[model samples]
Target: MFQHSRLTEFLLGLFAATSILAPSAAHALGGDGDKVVARVVTFGGACEKCDLSGRRMSGAQILGANFSGAALVGSDMRSVRVLGANFSGADLSRADLTDSEMIGSNFSNANLSNARLRGVQARGVAFSSAIMVKADLRDTEAQGANFSRADLSSAQFNDTSLQGAVLSRVDGRGASFRDAALQGANLSSGRFDRAIFVDASMDGAVLNGGQFDGADFRDASLHRAALFGADLSGARNLDQDQINHACSDASTRLPKGLVPRTCRGVTPHWSPKAPPAPPAPPAPPRP
Candidate 1:
C-alpha cells in the first residue's frame, strides 16, 4: 500500500514538471514538425537559409538581416520594413509584401514569382536575375533599383516609379507599365514583347537594341528616349509625333509609314523632368 502511494506521488510530480516545462520548450523552439512558426516581431542579424515558409510576418522589421537563400514562400509579409537586408537566392514565391519598405536590399537571383508588391518602396534595391513572373508591383516606387537580366513576364507596374532603374537585358514580355515613370531608366537589350506602356513616361530612357514587338505605346512620352537598333515594327499606337520626340537610328524598326530620326547631334525638345516623389515610408518597428 505504501509503495502504491509513492508511485502516485511520483506520477503527480512528473505531470507538474511537464506542465511547467512544456510552455518554455514550445516558446524557445517553436515549430510544428519540420516547419517553424516563429512569433518573432523584429528580425535582425543573420538567418541564412532559414525556412520561414507560410509564416505570417506582417509589419515585421528586418534591419540589416542576412536571410540569403531562405525559403519564404507564400509568407504574409505585408507592411514589412526590410532595410539593408541580403535576400539573395531566396525563394519568396507568392509572398505578399504590399506596402512594404525595402531600402538598399539585395534580392539578386531571388524567386519572386506571383509576389504581391503593391505600393512597395524599394529604393536602390538589387533584383538582378530575379524570377518575378506575374508579380504585382503596381504603385511601387523602385527608383534606382537594378532589375538587370530579370524575368518580369506579365508583371504589373501600373503607376509605379522606376526612374533611373537598370533593366538592361530583362525579359519583360507582356508586362504592363501603364502610367508608370521610367525616366532615365535603362531598358537596353531587353525583350519587352507585347508589353504595355500606355501613358508611361519614358523620357531619356535607353531602349537601345531592345525588342518591343507588338507592344503598346499609346500616348507614352518618349522625349529624349534612345531607340537605336530597337525592334518596334509591330508596335501599336506609335504616332509620328512620338517617334519625333525619341532619338532613333536607321536600324530602329518602326511601323509602316513611320520614319526615325538620327540621334547624332540632335538636341532634345524638352528638358527632363523628375517624377513626383513617392510617399514617405512608415516608421520602423520598435525593438
Candidate 2:
C-alpha cells in the first residue's frame, strides 16, 4: 500500500505544488539561475554540491528549472511535473521517473544510463545525444520527442508509445521493444543490432539503413513501414504465421518459420550499398 499511496500523493501533491509554483516558475525560464536554483536548496535535501544522487522526490513541480551540471544519479522523481526543465550535463543514471510528466524538458548531453522512465508522459522532450544505456521505458508515452544520436543500448521499452518521435542515428544495440507502438517515428540509420520487437507496431516508421543482426521480431506488425536498406543477418523469431513474406524483404532479417530470399541491401550507418541488378530470365524447361 505504500507504493500505491505514494502514487496517489504524487498526483495530488504535484498538482498542488504546480498550482503554487506556476506563477513564479515562469520567471526562471530559459537560463535563469537564481530563481530556479533556490528550490534546490529550499527542500533541504542532500544536495550538497548539487548532488541528489539516489534521493527520492516523488511529487514535485519543477517547471522551467535549471539543473545544469547537477548530479541526480539514482534518484526517484516519479509522477513529478518537469515541464521546461533543463537537465543538461546531469547524471541521472538509475533514476526512477515513472509516470512523470516532462513536457518540453531538455536533457541535452545528460547521462541517464540505466535509468527507469516507465509509463511516463514526455511530450516534446529533447534527449539529443543523451546516454540511456540499459534504461527501462516500458508503457511510456513519449509523443513528438527527439532522441537523435542517443545511445539506447540494451534498453527495454515493451508496450511503450513513441508516436512521431525522432530517433535518428541512435545506437540501440540489444534494445527490446516487444509490443511497442512506433507509428510515424523516424529511426533512419540507427544501429539496432540484436534488438527485439515481438508483436510491435511499426506503421509509417522509417527503418532505412539500420542493422538487425541477431534481432527478434516474433508476430510483429510492419504495415506500410519503409525498409529501404538494412541488414538482417542471423535474425530470429520470424515465422510466416506471424508476418507475411510480402511485408519486409532481403535487406530485412526474417524471423523464424520463414525462408531466406534476396532482399534489397541498404547498409546502415557505416556504408551505403549499390543498386539492384536487372531482372534475370527463367530456365528453359529445366534442360
Candidate 3:
C-alpha cells in the first residue's frame, strides 16, 4: 500500500515538471533577443504594427499572422513560410526574402521598396497596388501573382518567371528585366517608360494601351504578343519583323521604318500558338 502511494506521488511530480517545461520550449522558438517576444511565431499571435525590425525570422512559420502596418525593416525572412498572412500596408523595406514561400499572402498597398525577393516562390500572392520601387526579384517564381497598379520603378527582374501575372496599370519606369519570362501576363495600360527588356521573353502577353515611350527591347522576344493600342513610340532596338509578328492596332505608335499597318489590321489575342512546321520536313529530303 505504501509503495503504491509513492508511485502515485512520483507520477504527479513528473506531470508537474512536464507542464512547467512545455511552455518554455514553445516560447524558445520565438527567439529570446532584445525584441519583444510578446507572441510566438509557431502558434501565431496578433501583433498589428509590431516592431519586428532587424529580427531574425529565418525559416519561421507565420501563417495567417496579422502584420499590417508592422515595421519589418532589414528583417531576414529567408526561407520563411508565411502562407495566407496579412501584411497589408506593412513596411518591409530592405528586407531579405530569398527563397521564402508566401503563397496566397496579402501584401496589398504594402511598402516593399528596396526589398530583395531573390528566388522567392510566391505563387498566387496578391501584391495589388503595393509600392515595390527598386526591389530586386531575381530568379523569383511568382506565377499568377497580382501586382496591378503597383509602383515598380527601377525594379530589377533578372531571370524571374512571372507567367500569367497580373501587372495591369503598373508604373514600371526604368525597370530592368533581363531574360525574364512574362508569358501570358496582363500588362494593359501600364507605364513602362525607359524600361529595359534585354533578352526578355514576353510571348502572348497583353500590352494593350500601355505607354512604352523610350523603352528598350534589345534581343527581346514578343512573338504573338498583343500590343493593341500600345504606345511604343521611340522604343529602341526593335525591328520591322518583331512588330509584324505581334498584334497591334492603329493607335499603336511604332519606331521608325516600322509601319503601323502590320499590327493595325487585326485585333489582339493573348494565347500561345505553335510555330510553323519546317516546310513539311523539306519534302523528306527529296526522297
Candidate 4:
C-alpha cells in the first residue's frame, strides 16, 4: 500500500527536473537555495523530482533522505530530523512539521495539507494514501502508524498516541480525537463524519465499517470495542450504558436510545483506562 519505488537506493536516477541548487551566499536559507548544504545537514543525497518549494529547513538533518517526487510547498520543517526519510510522492503543502522526528518515515502519497504535526515523533510511520487535510496532529506520537486510505479531513488529533494504529479506509471528516490514545486500533472502513471523540481511548478498538455521523463520543472509552457494521447515526456522547459496554453486533446501528447487542460472541470485559497522558512535550524548538 506504500508504493513509489524507483529502485530505491536514494531512488536511482532521480527522475529529472534538477537545476535548483544555489546554496552559497553564506549558506542561504530562504529563496529555496541552500539545498541543505550542511548548516545542520545530515542529508545523504538523492532528491527525486525536487523543487523544495519555499525551503527554510529549520533544524535540518534529513536522515536517510530521498524525498521522492518532492515539492515541499511552504517548507520550514521545524526541529526536523526526518528519520528514515522517503516522503513518497511528496508535496507537503504549508509544511512546518513542528518538533519533527518522523521515525521510519515514508508518507506514501504525501500531501500533508496545512501540515504542522505538533510534537511529532511518528513512530513506525507509513501514512499510506496520505493527504492529511488540515493536519496538525497535536501532541503526536503516532505509535504503529499506517493510516490506510488516509484523508483525515480537518485533522487535529489532540493528545494523540494512536497505539497499534492501522486506521483502515480512513477519511475522518471534521476530525478531532481529543485526548486520543486509540488502544489496539484498526478502525476498519472509517469515515467519522463530524468526528470529535473527546477523552478518547477506544480500548481494543476495531470499529468495523465505522461511519459515526455527527460523532462526539464524550468521555469516550469503548472498552473492548468492536462495533460490527458500525454506523452510530447522530452519535453524541453515546449512552445506553455505552452500548452495553462495547462489543456490539446485531449489525450495530444505534442513535436514538440504543438497544442492539444480541450477537453474543462476548468475551471482552477488561475495563482498563488510565494510560494516555504523556504526549505534550516536544513543541519548544522552533525559535
Candidate 5:
C-alpha cells in the first residue's frame, strides 16, 4: 500500500542506482558513494531480501562494494564496473546483464539460475560451486572465469566466447551451445548429459573424465581437445568428417562406428572466427 509520492521517489532512486557501468578486470573499482545502497534499501530491501529486479544499473562503478550474501534476484546490472565486488553466496537468479562488465566479481556459491546475460564481459569472475541452471548467456565473454563445481543444467551459450574459462566438475545437462567459441576452455569431469553443441567451436578445450550421455555434437569443432577417460556413450550425430576435424581418440565411442585411426591425438576443430583469408588483390574491372 505505498502512496503515489513514495512510489515515485522509489522508482527514481532505483533508476539512479542501476545505471552505472563497470570495467573488464577482476579488481576492485573506485567509487565511495552511498547512491546505490540508499536506493536499494528504499525499494526492495524489505526485512531480508532486496527486490531490485530489472533495475537498470548499467556501467556503474561499484568497486569494493560488499554485496556478499545479498539477494540480487533478477537485477539488471549491465555494464557495471564492480571489480572485486564480494557477491559470495548471493542470489542473482534471473538477472538481466546485457553488455555489463563484471570483472573480478566474486559470485562464489551464488544462485544464478535463469539469469539472462547476453553480451556481458565477465572475465576473471569467480563462480566456484555456483548454480547457474537454465541461464541464458548468449553472446557473452567469460574468459578466464572460474565455475568449478558449478551446476549449469540447460544453460544456453549461443555465439558466446569463453576462451580459457574453467568449468571443472560442472553439471551441464541439457545445455545448448549454438555457435559458441570455447577455445582453451577447461571442462574436466563435467556432466554433459543431453547437452546440445550445434556449431560450437571447442578448439583446445579440456573434457577429461566427463559424462556425455545423450549429448549432441552437430557441427562442433574439438581440435586438440582432450577427453582422457571420458564416457561419450550415447553421444549422437558425431559424423566421420567432424570426428576427423576435431581429433577424437579411442575413448570417444560412437553408437556403432569404426574407431577412427587418423584421430589419435585431440581433434582438429576451428575457432569461432577463423583467420580471414588473404584479401584478393584489388581487381581492375574493365567495362
Candidate 6:
C-alpha cells in the first residue's frame, strides 16, 4: 500500500510540473507554429549575407549592424529601429516595416519589391539603385534620402514627404505621388510615364530632361519648379496658371499654346516646415 501511494504522489507531481512548464515553453517558442520567432532582441555588428527570411522581429533595434546581402523577405519588422545599418543588396521583398525608423541606413541596390513601408522615417538613408517595384510607401518621411537610379515602377508614395530627396534617374512609371511633398527633390532624367502627382507640392523640384508622358498633375503646385528639357506634352490636367508658376526653358516640351517662362526671381508659394518627430519605440516583449 505504501509503495502504491508513493508512486501515485510522484506521478501527480510530475504532471503538475509539466503543466506549469508547458505553457512557458510554448510561449518561448512563439505560440504560433507558422511564424519563426527571433532569438535575440537587439541586433548589432556584422551579419552580412545572413538568411533571416520570414522571421518575426517586430520592434527590434538593429543599430549600426551590417546586414548587407541578407535575406529578410516576408519578415514582420514593424516599428524596428535600424539606425546606421548597412542593408545594401539585401532582399527585403514583402517585408512589413511600417512605422519604422531607419535614419542614415544604407540600402543601396537592395530588393524591396512589394514591401510595406508606410509611415517610415528614413531621413538620410540611401536607397540608390534599389528595386522597389510595387512597394507601399504611403505617408513616409524620407527627407534628404538618396533614391537615385532606383526602380520604383508602380510604387505607392501617396502623401509621402520627399523633401530634398534625390530621385534622379528613377524609373517611376505608373507610380503614384498624390498629395506628396516633393519640394526641392531631384527627378532629373527619370521616367515617370503615367505617374500620378495629383495635388502634390513640387516646389523647386528639378525635372530637367525627365519624361512625363501621360502623367497626371491635377491641382499640383509647381511653384518655382524647374522644367527645363522636360517632356510634358502628353501630361494631363496641367493649366496655364500652374505653368506660369513653374520655371520652364525653350527645351521644355509643353502642351500646345503654353509658353515657357524663365526661372528668374520666382517666389515660391509653399513654405518649408521641420519634419515631425519620429514615433516612439515599441515596448519590449514580455519575459
Top-TM-score structure, candidate number: 6
Candidate 4 vs candidate 6: the TM-score winner is 6
Instruction: Quote model 6's TM-score.
Output: 0.81
What TM-score would each prediction reach against the true structure?
A: 0.80, 0.69, 0.77, 0.34, 0.72, 0.81
Which is superior by lDDT, 3 or 6? 6
Q: Worst ten-residue run, lDDT, model 5? A: 39-48
Candidate 5 lDDT score at position 224:
70
Q: Supply the global lDDT for candidate 3.
A: 0.75
**Structural RMSD, model 2:** 17.8
Candidate 3 on 131-199: residue-level lDDT in tens?
A: 999999889987788899999999998898888888899999998888998888899999999998889
Q: Please state the error at residue 198 of candidate 5 in Å.
A: 1.1
Note the residue pairs that clash in candidate 2: 209-268, 229-266, 238-255, 238-256, 250-263
Tens digits of per-residue lDDT, candidate 1, 1-287, equal 12333423433343344335555564676533111222234445556676777766676677776778888999878888788778999999999999999887889999999999999989778999999999999999898889999999999999999988889999999999999999889999999999999999999898999999989999999988999999999999999999998999789999999999776675343222332333333343343
TM-score-wise, the better of 1 and 5 is 1
TM-score of 2: 0.69
Error of 6 at 221 (Å): 0.1
Worst 10 residues of 6 by lDDT: 32-41
For all candidates, the clash counts are: 0, 5, 0, 0, 31, 0
Better lDDT candidate (2, 6): 6
Q: What's the distance in Å from true for residue 108, model 2?
A: 2.1
Ordered from best to worst TM-score, the candidate numbers read 6, 1, 3, 5, 2, 4
lDDT of 4: 0.74
Q: Is candidate 3 or candidate 6 better by TM-score?
A: 6
lDDT of each: 0.82, 0.67, 0.75, 0.74, 0.68, 0.83
